[model samples]
Structure formats: structure tokens, C-alpha cells
Target chain A: MATIKDVAKLAGVSASTASRALHDSNMISEATKERVRKAMAELDYSPNYAAQNLVNRKTNTVGIVLPVRENQDSLGNNPFFMQIIQGISSICSENDYMVSLATGRSNEELQKNVQTLIRSGNIDKLIFLYSKKGDPIFDYVKQQKVSCVVVGQAYDALTDHIQYVDNNNFQAGYDAAVFLGQKGYHNIVYAYTDLEELVQAERYEGYQSYIKQQGLRDHHLGLSRVDNRANLEKLQSFLAKNPEIEAFIACDDIQAIRLQRLFKEADIANNRYALLGFNNSLITEIANPSLTSVDIFPQELGEEAANLLLKKILQESQTLIIPHQIIERESTASIK
Target chain B: MATIKDVAKLAGVSASTASRALHDSNMISEATKERVRKAMAELDYSPNYAAQNLVNRKTNTVGIVLPVRENQDSLGNNPFFMQIIQGISSICSENDYMVSLATGRSNEELQKNVQTLIRSGNIDKLIFLYSKKGDPIFDYVKQQKVSCVVVGQAYDALTDHIQYVDNNNFQAGYDAAVFLGQKGYHNIVYAYTDLEELVQAERYEGYQSYIKQQGLRDHHLGLSRVDNRANLEKLQSFLAKNPEIEAFIACDDIQAIRLQRLFKEADIANNRYALLGFNNSLITEIANPSLTSVDIFPQELGEEAANLLLKKILQESQTLIIPHQIIERESTASIK
Candidate 1:
């Protein structure tokens, strides 16, 4: 809470001299600078960054823009976002950059808050948690020439301008099918939610390519738009018709966990089907029998996004693809 | 991105007049105010709040101070913290206040960041997620006379000035024991972590009180400082010594989930021991038999904290205790 006057008085210098010394102006002599530094340190003075930002136009902070969730009740409750924040915060801490989160119950509100944050010059860069088409915030950031990076896969056409960090989701999907096929599972289903999500689409495409190349069949079960109970019933009927299905490639770990719970409720034997999930999140480990999942390395994705955004802020440009690995666990392991 | 000049030109007034109109100064006539409002709306001009804050000294933002974690890798990865944030964000959104997180890898770094944040005047209120003893940030906030509300139980003497929101943890603990005792599980264990944590301490006190009143023996297990494997081995050994123990009251859901996993790995039959956990978090649902946990209503806790902080900021003071409930699930259901 020490002011410039206090530092000046403590150092036996004028307020202007103290200010100059703090700002490292050439007008302040080395002795005066040393005295002012000692005085400020003694007083525990913290330079007001907001006041400095008015002249520098930089806040040394990154603004994290969260995607407007479909489930408003679960806002900030998603483990995926929590992991991304952990990655982002770790990197930001290392770089001495502060982080501020921008969220809203709706997209319009989210966009408005983002605009306010940007216009107020509270952040030097923006790291978006998702990259969806026709997003106003994305369009605004692009039009305003702001330094930004998206954590999800970007559209093919937009990738040239919008840099992003993501995993090879398509290859991950293909590998899931190949892994199951090698495990002696012939009929495999690609089960997922949020069919409109680009990651899900790409993963599904990978599943399609793999099934075709291997002379296998493809069955898509969409659960994104439906409620959990409805999705469970739909899954049950599908399994009844296609009892030959020996394995399923789920889009993410939560869905895979849900599928496992449903299987248990339906009295389906554990060895009857193998389930492969993505994200290798904690849920996979907590799920009974555990879960075999593709470790998309979400934290790495977040770290990559932060690194890319920092690069963009420094006038550098780069796109990054975080690697993914399959973690074979009880869900896909041979039952003893 | 629109400027005051643009609004002035569109409203047929000078920039000064436009600014006054925007500020709603009494010197500006109603007619001019109406014109400026229309121009601002037409151009989608947002007044710079940061500049206004320099005068009004309010940021309409809350600074959420997290406990400095020893586990640097899992920063912001705690699901319990995530749920609290969900609650905080929901209430903040409802009140049109922004949420910013302040955390660091070390206590010193955390204090520095908090000081900078406070000195920069970027937040009007601070909400601490924990109230452990000898917390430098807590001491600083108290010394600075800053508006704050703790989310956990504070020491009895400090509660006079520090408004807090918490459950009756003693009752919650007592209720856990009584719930198990009522179900014919006479010999029960109170399992917890971080006895230093006030919540855990209060819960343990409640458990002790219950055991004394019921004339049943009390056994305590501490796992906070130990690694999971070590804790599991210790638990296995404890169970070996006390095979008559019929139930466990884990301090939280994550611990409960871990206990369930350990029991399964150790080949302990589920029906042999009942388990009860706190927080009714997602892990409970994902656990094999589905855990029965105490629902402390984390979202409501967050809402209450925000409400209390707002009231304190507005010159009101009141301590609040949010209600807790027991959620019965397969983990505590009658043995089949």
C-alpha cells in the first residue's frame, strides 16, 4: 500500500525521482535507483500494473475464454476444463503471467464479457478452450487482430489463419478400432456424444476409415442430443439387434463410464464387450474394471495452447499437435 | 471497440458532453442523455470499466484465493474445488460479478500475486477457499481490512469478524456414524485426511461425540500426508486387525472412492463393510456400487459465500451454515 511519495520520502528523493527510478527512466541516477529500490522493498511496495497498463497497453495476463456450455448447471464443473486450466495456469505461472477466466451462462453474454475484457486491455492474449464454427468471439478476435490460440481442432479452411493445439484425434480413433481388431474383436461400434463437435466428427471419420480398410462394419450411435436415460435405452436396443458387437470406441471417458454403468445395470457380462474411451481422464481409472482409453493428454493440449498463444503474443506463429497414446486397462484388457 | 468520439459524432454532441451523458451527470439534460444512449446503443459502445474503476474504486469482481498446493502438477485439478467454482461462478453470473482465480505454486508466490492483485485494485472482494492456520494471505487480508469471506470453518475466536459459510460438520460426522449405527453397523471407523483441516477436525469431533454417546469404540485413520499405496497398505493392515469393523466414514468422496478401489484390490467383499463419504461428488456415482455420501450442497455453499461477501461489502455481517443431507446409495444399502 506504499505510495510513490512514501518511497520518495524513505529514499530522500522527490516523488518524480522515485517514480522515474521505479520505471527505470534514464533521468534517475544509479544511486537514486538503488536507494528507491531498497526503500520500495522495505515498504513492501507493489507497483500498480493496471496504472502502468494504461501507458503500456499490456496487462501481462492471459484471458481464458470458456465455451458456453450446453449444460449451464455444470458450468466450471467439467473436469476437462479444470485440466485445461491446470495446464494453462502452470505455464502462466512459469512465465509470470496472470490468468483471468471469462464465462457466461449463454454465448451472447460470453461474447459481450470477452469484448469488454479485450477492449479494457485487461489481457495480452486469449486462449479459447474450443473452436466451433460461427462463434462470435472467434470472429471478433480474428477481426480485431488479437493474439489468440484455440485448444481444439480448427476447421480446414480456417487453420491457415487461426492457429490451434490439438491431438491427432482421427488417428486416435483409427487406432482404437485397430487395437480392438487386433484383440480379436470383430464387430466394433463407434459410440459418441455431440456429433456436431469437430473432434467427434474427425474421430468418427477415423473409425469409418479403419473399418473400411479392415473389411469390418461401422455402426454409429449418437448420444449428444438425447438425455442419458434415452441414450441408455437406445444403446440397449442397438446391442439387442447387434449382439455380435464385441467392442465400442467411445468419444470420451465420461461417455465410456456411462456406457459401463449402463452395461452393469443391463446385466451385461464384463467379458462380453470391450470398451475403448478417449481422454484417459480420472474417470477411466475410477470406473470399475477400469477403462482402456486414448490418452489425448489434455494437460499437454492446454500447455501447448498456452505456449502457442504466448508465441503469437510475441509475434511468433506456430501450430501444434499434442500426441495421443492408448492406455490399455481392464476395460480392454484380457479378462482373466 | 467504439470510442466516445464516435458516440459524440453520432449523437451530434461534443465528446465531453457525450462522456457526461454516459456518466449520467446531473449537469447533462435528459434530452442529451437520451441521444447519447441511442448513439451508444447504435454503435454498441461499452464504457471502459477499468478507467471508471480508477475513480469509483470498484471492479465488480471477486478474487478467489485457493490454498497453496504441495502437489504442483495437479493445480486446479481438484474436483471438490471445481464444484466450488461451479457454485461460485453461478452466483457471480447471477449477480453480474466477474470471478478471477489467484493461486501460486508456493505460499510466497501466492502472497506476492495476491498483493499485486490487491494493490492493483483489480478486485473489490476476496473469497478464500480454505481457512487453515498461519495462512499469510489470510493474515494480510485481515490486516488490510479487505472484504473477505472464508468458505470453511474458522477458529472460534476469528469467527467474530470473519464471516464464513460452512455445514455443521460435527453434525454431518455424527449423522454419518448414527446412520451406520442405525443400519446395524455397530463397529465403525472414521477415516479422514489432513486432521489439520478444520472441516476434518470438526467432523472427527462429531464422530467422537457420537461414539461416546452410543457406547461404541472409535477408530481414526489419517491418510492426508501419505501416498495412496502407503495409505492403502495401512488401511489393509488396520482392517486385518479390526475385521469386526463394519462401516467407514470417509472425509470426502474421493477418499471413499479410493477406499472402495483398495477394498476391491485387496479382495474385500463389498457387502462386508459399508462406506459413507462426504460431498456427494461425481466419484460417488462412478464408484462400482455407487457411494452414499453427505450432500453438503457445494453450489449452495458457493452461493451463500458470495451472498455473505456481498452483504459484508455492503456493510452487513452474518454467519451462515448451509444444510447438509445424506444421499443413500448402493455403498450403504442393505446387504443382499
Candidate 2:
């Protein structure tokens, strides 16, 4: 209930001095600032953020933009986003900054919402949860000259102009195939959804390169977002035609699980084919055979992104690659 | 970059009138507001939210409080919180209000952070993501008289004074028992963790009531948040002693999956016991044997809570009970 005037009187300083001290403005001497702080502590004064924001021209808030996924269900079902958010939220909380989410069902809506968020001056910085080439939101943020960070691979054109944190998804895919091959499973295939996404493209490229280097016949399976009847039939036909395929490397854990279900329906025994997935999420542990997955360290990616965005001067566009680790589980236990 | 003055000039009104019209203040005529809207559209003007907030004394932001769990990993592992947040985010975005997350590692830290959020005048409303009996955060928010809504059951003392949205957890528990009972499973046991939470306590009470009514010997299993060796040993012993228990109703899908893993290790056959869990989350679909779960409609709960908090007048302290349904899956398909 104590006002700035009261704090100023108790600290033996003018109201303006107390206000400046509250913000730790260099204009006020350290002695006066310390006196004002003690007075504030004695009176338990909590400065109004809105008022301070106006004075400092800073909101002390971060905006997190979630990609508008084609499959809306993925927005809720995917634990990857939540894990990254957890990492981001932890760092933001520690820094005394609040996090605000910006999401939409479509790109147009997402762009408009983000525009409004930035124009409103409610956020000091922004963190894009995903990255894609030629994203309008990315361009808009760049034009606005706002301090921002991306949590995935930036487009090649903007690589030197943007700050991003990502796992070496290419290496992850190559490693998955190599790990399975090391176990003597030479007939391995890559499974993915939405090859248009840079993540899928990069990972597939890595897998394809490995296959070519080893002189193995390369086979890949594409899946729809939803597990509809068409998808099941496709999986069944693929399995029937490629009976020699002994293992699969999926782009994500969810896809791995869905494929596992489809494989079961096709009457394929669990041990008949080994499976490896990415994003060692919770489902990996609960999965029927307990999935062998690549841990991309999503939380660390988020944390690094936040750290980059909060930097005082983002003079040099920095790219931090969080390492990925392959976790061996029951699904990949088959030894030759 | 057009200002209010430009809009006012184009609308043939004073700057003050244009500002009021922008807010759609009751004092402004509909004709004048329409004129100002046209001018704003023509100029592509965006109002600075901080300045507007100062004038309106409203932040147009919602604070979401996540419970401080003893097991920190649960904060990220459990999809329940993320689902709720997605629901809250969608609704808040629709209303053009930003959602801010308030989280901490301990009860004391959570309380302090929430207090700071409120006192900072940065949020127009607050939503507590979890409910616990006699929680200090609940008491503090109530004392502050902030427009707030709880996403779980209010304690008995505050039931009449708080607005809350929750599933009938007790009924969900009772229904789980009845669903299994109707399947001709006479011997049923309940599995849960941390009964101190009202959710666990209420569900257990319902399960216990059904067991006593049916003249069946009630058996229960308690597991820790993490799958530690101690927990595995405890589960092993419980299963060893309750070999005759035909069905198990778990408090959540995650716990059910954990139990399934433990049961597998103990050499219990999938067909040997019918397993049912709550919170029909993503894990249910991925779990081996797939879990039959009670869909508590978590997103709806979150949406309803946001709706209640954003209401113009929360005079009645409304309590909404979202209905729960049993989602049958492979885990509970056996008719024995």
C-alpha cells in the first residue's frame, strides 16, 4: 500500500529520484539507489510493471510463437512443444520475465496475431517455436528489427541473419541408420511425414546419404498426419512388398508409435522389424516394445534460444546446435 | 504508423473522441465509432497497448498458475498441464488477450511469483491450473479479490465463494469401477499416487465406496511419481500378493502404463488383468495393449475456466462439472 512518495520521503530523496532508483537507472547514484531499495523493502513496495514499462520502454515479457500445424491435433498431442516451453519458461522465470504464447490455426492468423503482439509493445522479445523456409512471420520480425530467436534450423538465406538453436537433425537421422546398421540390420528404411518441412528434408537427406554410401537399396515411407484407413493400407502394402526391410527410422516418436500400431494390424510381429524414433518423448517409454529414440534435447534447444534472445546485443547471428543422443530400447533390441 | 490524431482528423472528430471510439466506450456514438474504425482501417493504424493500458487500467492479459510439483519432471512429462494450457491459449487468443505462465519450483516460490504477477498490474485475470485443499495460493488470490477461476475442485471452505471448472473426479472413479464391474471383473484394485491431492483423494473415495458396496475386498496400490527401484519393488510385491485381482483402475494413463511395465516385468500376462486409467491422453494410444481411459475433457475444463474468468461479472461463483466418458481400448477388451 506504500506509494513512491512515501518511499522517497523515507529514503530522504525526491520522488523522481526514487522512481529512477526503482528502475536502477544510472542517473541515480548507487548510494541513493541502495537507500531507496532498503526503504522499499521496509515498506514491501512492489512496483507496478505497467508503469515501469512505460518509463523504461520495455515490457519484460517474451512472446513464444507456436507453428500453425496442418494437423491441429498435433498442437496438443506432441510433447515436444511442451518440453521446449518448459525449458523456455524455466529460464524466463529465473530471469524475472513472463512468457506469453502466440498461436493460431493458420499462418495468416498467426501472422496477424504476432503483428498485433509486437505492435502493441507488450513483448520485449520473441521466440519462434519452429522454423521453416520463406515463413512470412520470420520476414516480418526481421523487418521490424525485433530481437528474436528461432528454435529450429533457419533457412539458408537467413542463416547468417538469424539467431537459432537446433539439434543436428541431419546427424540424428544418419546416426539412427548407422546405429541400426551397426546392430546388423542392413535393410533399414526411413519413415516421415511432411517432407516439405526442413526438418524432414534434412533428416531424409542424411539417411539417403548413408544408404548410398553403404550401397544399400534406399527405401522411404511417407505417412499422413492422421492414422486413417488409407494410411493403414499403404503401410500394409509397403510391408508386403518390402519383406526384406528389417528396420525403420521414424522422424518422430508419434509416427513411430502409429507405425507400430499399423505393423501390428498387418500381423507383423514386434520382433520382425526393428524401429527407431526421434524426440525421445514420454511415449517412447510407454510404447509396446518401448521405442528406441533419438533424444534431440528439446529443452536445451529452448533454453539456448531464450538465452540468445535475451542477450543485450545480438550483433552476431549465433547458431547453437544442441547434440542428440540415441536411446536403445526394446524396439531395437534385435541383434541381426 | 498513423496516430490517433490522424484517425481523428480523417474521422472529423477530436483526438480524445477517436481514442474513446477505438475502445468502443459506451459514451461514444455508434456512428462516430464506425467512422473512426473506417479511418483506422484506411490508415492501418495500430494502437500501442501500453499507452492504452495506462488509460484503461486494463492489461488484457491472463496469468496461468502451474502447480509446483514435488517431482519437477512431472511438470514437463505430464501432458495434462500442456493440454490445459493449449485450451487456455486458444480461448485467450480468440479474445485478443495474451496468456502468461506463472510457475515456480516450490510452493513458496510459486506464491511469491503469483503475488508479483498480480501486484505488477500486468494481468487482468488469473487462472490456477490445479486445485489443492487449503493451498496458500488459492487463499491469497481470494483475499486479493482478483477476477480468477480455478481449473479444479475448490476446497470445501471456498466452494461457495470460488468459480471453478472440473470433472466430477469422484464420479469418474465410480464409473471406472462400474465399467470394470459390468465386464464381470469381480476383483478390482485402485492404483494412485499422492492422495494428498484432492483429485486423488476424491477419486479414491469413489472407488472405495464402490468396493464396499459390492462386498468386495478393496485393494489399492500406491506408486511414486518416478519409476524408482523402490517403486518397482513396491509394485512387484503388490502384484505378488494380489494375484487374484482381476482388474486395476489407475488414477491416470501414465500410472497405468507404468503399472503395465511393472506387470510385464513380474511376468503378468496382458490378458491376465484388465487395466483402466484416467485422462485419455496421448499415452493411452501408445501404451502397450493401449489403455482404456476415462476422458476427463481436460481441454474443455481449461476452456470453461477461461470463459468463467473472462466473464463480465462473476457474481454467482459458478461451478461447472464437465462430463467424463470411458474410452474403451485394447487394455480393457477382455470380457473375463
Candidate 3:
């Protein structure tokens, strides 16, 4: 209800001087800034981010688009997203910025939302959680040449560079397999999801590479795609077929928890088949016997992503990796 | 960057006609509305929420103040808030709106952010998650006659005109005691948060009332103060002094889980102690023997809160109460 003129009158300064002090623009004296700040606080003066964005071409709001399909694949019930978001939010809130969420079903819908935000001049920066090859979302980002940072890999088809942070899933998978081998569990299996997603594929490859490295190239690889009912059944079938398989490594913790349920149904004794899970979500700790899990530091990953985006927005131009810790709990104990 | 004029030109209509069609103004026909919609899809037109908001004096953005304290309430460990937020987002997204998070050390900072958004004219509604006696955050809502739906209750001094969706904490506490009593437990203890929080105090009353009704009015009560450490120590002291207190009811799952850990350290087996927890959060399920807890449906509560806020925003004015469910897990068992 109060205007800049009222604030200036209350602060005993010219309207132009008050405006400059409020904006902290060039040439505003510190004394004037303090006077203006106190007056603004008294009057509850709030700046319109949208109007300011129109004038100065900055919104100071980041758009986070989480595209949830029919299944909400890789997302629904995943604690990982929450931690990453907390990380991003913690930094954003500290820096006096706000986060907005957008959802889409189809590529067309995703493109519509992104384009609408750009054309309507709502958010200046966008952070996408999911990435795809030849994504239409990327097409518009490239055309507008707006700032963006993605959690997943961007397509090589576009020349627009994006800052990203990802765990070394391949290396993690390799290390899990190698550790099991050193523990004398030769017939190890990799329980995975999708098998199409880049992260899953990389981990699968890592398991294969590690097996070859350990001269156990004859190992049987077990595949169980999560979300598919048949995949849950395949886990049970795999157990029935492979008595020699003493250790199993899951691509992620959710899948590992599911397998633990099946193992209980089979009445399999603990350590009869060692289990290792990834991402170290609460599921690992909740599994009846607890679970050995790879800690991806999702919270740190989220923080790094936010910092990366902020750096890019500020033109600092930095990129880096976040380390992972292997938390050995009850699930991956040595087989007697 | 296509405007209504471009859409009108492409559709062979006047600019005024396009505007009427987009707004569904009576001046336009249904056929024209369909044509304009198709054109909008092709050109990716997004009816500017801000411009509309400025004209109508309502942005439809709801502020959810988290009350993240200076000490930071260790909420990072649980997935409860995350699920609630996602549920809130789902409803907001469906109604074409955005949810912004607000957290501050003191109520002054909280009021500052709210005032900022209020002045920016960016949000038309508020949903305060945490409320304390004489809370400054609720002061703005009352002083400004703002349309707000608080998630929890504030001080009795605060105006009661503002709507809220608070859990029946008193009922939850009564049910915990009743359930434990039915199981043949004689000396049950009540463990909870600070009495300064009106909701927790209600729960304590519920426990006391239930015990009085059962003719066991001398039950032990342990109040876990604000800091988790303080609560832990209080719980430790309760265990040290009361050996006859064979059963305990924790106000929340987090507290119950911590109590279980303490019991383990004390060489007292869980289920041996008959622990019951409120808010069937992930921690309860993940704890040893799985905690028996009351499912408050935090996500559903969030959805309910958002629905109520939007209803008030649209002048629909309907107040509702969402129920709590009791989940009987392994933390407590029947003595019979």
C-alpha cells in the first residue's frame, strides 16, 4: 500500500535517491542506503520481482521442472529427490532466491510449460531434473539462449552447454563387485532397473568390466527391472535358479529393499546371499537385517547442483564431482 | 514472442476478439474459443498469471512458512516434510499455481519475507506450517486480513478468523494409551515434545485424560524439549527413575525411534518396553522391530491444507477435517 514516494518522504530524501538506495544501484551513499532500508522496513516496502525483472532482465527465481509420467519413474517414492531439492533450496533461500516447480506429462507439454515461462518472462533460470535425447525442452533453451543446469545428461545434438552433477555409478558398481570378489563371493549378481537409463547401463557395464578384471568372466548376470510386476517375479526366480550366487548388488536401494522382501519369503538365511544397495536411502537401514549401501550423498549432490547453477548464473563457470562413501551395514556382510 | 494480435491475425480475427476468446468473455463464441485455444497451443501462449494477477490484485501464489529454527530442527533426516510438500505441490499444480517455501530463525524474519511477497503482490494466500504463542508470523495475517489457512494452530490471542488443519493430537495420545492398556500394559509412560507447542500439549492432555479414565492417573510423563538432545536426556532420565513404566507412547515416530536406540544401549529389548509412536513416518518403519505408530497422513494433510487454502482464495469457503490412521507395527505388541 505504501509507495517509494512515501518511503522517500519518511526517510527525508528525494524519491530518486531513495530508489537508488533501495536498489543499491551505482553512486548511492551508504548513509542514504541505511536510511532507506529503515524506512522501507517500517513501511514494509517490498520490491516486485516480476516488474524488476522486466526492467533489469533478472527474475532471481529458478524454475525446477520435475516431469512425472504415468509411473513417476525414477522419482515416485524416491527419497533421493527430496534430499537434492533440500540442498538446492538451502542455498537458494540463503542467496535470497525462490524456487518454483513445473510438471509435464508429454514432451509437448514440457515444451509448452518451458516456452510459456520464457515468453511470459516469469523465471529467468531453469533447472531440469530429467533429461532426454533430442529433448524439445533443450531446443527452446538453445533458441532463447537462457541459463540452465540439468541433473541428467543433455543431448549432444545441441551445442548449448549445461552444467551438471552426477555420481560415478559405473565405478561404484565395479567397486561393489570387486569387494564381493575379494570376500570370496565369485558368483555375484547385479540387480538393476530400466537397463535403458544411462546410469543403470553404466553400472551394468561396470559390473561386467569388473568381473572381467577379476578373471570371473563366466559369472551369471541377473537383471530385474523395477516397476514391472514381472521384474519382481524375476527376482524370486533368480534366487531359485542360482544357489551358487552368494552376493547380489542392486542398482539402487529401492530395488534392494524389494529383493529383501522376496528373500524373506524364500526363508533364506541371512548371509546365505549377500546384498549390496546403492544410494543408501532409508530403505537400506530399514531392511530387516539392514543393508550395505553406497552413499551417493544425494543431499550434497543437490547442494553441488545448486551451487553449480548459481555459479553459472553469476558467470563464475565452474564444474566438479562429489565423492561417494560406501556404508557397510548388515546387508553385505561376509559369507562364512 | 507471439502476442494476442499475432494469434488474432493468424486466426483471421480482431485483437479484441482474440482477447475475449482467451478470457472466455461473453463477447466471444464457443467456436472462436476453440480456434483461439488451438492457435494458443500452436504458438505456445501462456496466459500471464502475473498480468492477470496485477489486474485482479491476486497472484494465487501461496506462501508455506516452515519455521526452520536457528538451530535447524534436524528435519533433513526424515522424508515427512518432503512428501507433504509434494502433495501440496500436486494440488497447487493442478489448480495452476505455485508454492513458495518460507523459513526463518525468528518470527520477525518470517514476517519480513511474508511482507516482501505481500508488497511484491506476488502471492495472494498463506499457509503457516508452525505456529507458536504470540507468533509474529500470524500477526501479519490478522493485521492485514490476509486469506490464510494455517497447517497448525496459533496462540489463542491470535484471531480465530483464520482457518487451520491441525491433527487431533489429543485423540492420538488417548488412542495410544487405550491401545496399550487393552494389551494388558499396567504402567504406561507418555513421551512428547514441549508444552509450549499447543499441539503437543493437547497430546499430553489426551494421555492424562485417558489414564485418569482408566483409573491409572499416576502414569509417568516425559516431555522431550525442543532440542532432540534435550528430549533424549529427558527420556534417559525417565528410564532411570521409573522401572515400572513398562510401556511408552512417543508423540512422534522420530522420538520413538530414538527411544528404541536408547533402550538398546540400556540392554532393554524393544517390544519388551512396548513402545508406541505418533506420525508413522519412515523412521518408525525403519527402526528395529518396526515401530507401531499413528499414520497422520502428512501428504494427505498437505493436500487437504492446499485444497482449503485454494477454496478460500476462490471464495468457496468450506472448512474440513482430515482424519488420522493408526498403523499397528512391531514397536508394540499385545501382552496376551
lDDT per residue (tens digit) for residues B1-336 in model 2: 899999999999999999999988999999999999999989988887777788777777889999886643566676677778877877887887878888777888778778878876777699998877678887888888578888887665344466878889899898999899998887888888888877877888889889889999888888886564576799778877877878899988878977887776666675678999998887677566778999987778788888887764444546688999999988887574
lDDT of 3 by residue, B130-167 (tens): 66667766776668756777676534624376666667
Candidate number achieving the greatest TM-score relative to the actual structure: 2
Cα displacement (Å) at residue B261, model 2: 3.5
C-alpha RMSD over true interface residues, each candidate: 2.9, 2.5, 4.4
lDDT of each: 0.78, 0.82, 0.69
Residue-level lDDT tens digits of model 2 in A192-226? 88888788878888898899899998999998864
Q: What local lDDT score does residue B143 receive in model 3, on the 0 to 100 scale?
A: 80
Q: Candidates sorted by DockQ, descending order?
A: 2, 1, 3
| Clash pairs for candidate 1 | none
User: How close is every model to the real structure, measured as TM-score?
Assistant: 0.83, 0.89, 0.77
- CAPRI classification of candidate 3: incorrect
Deviation (Å) of A8 in candidate 2? 4.5
Worst 10 residues of 3 chain B by lDDT: B312-321
Model 3 global lDDT (CA atoms, 0 to 1): 0.69
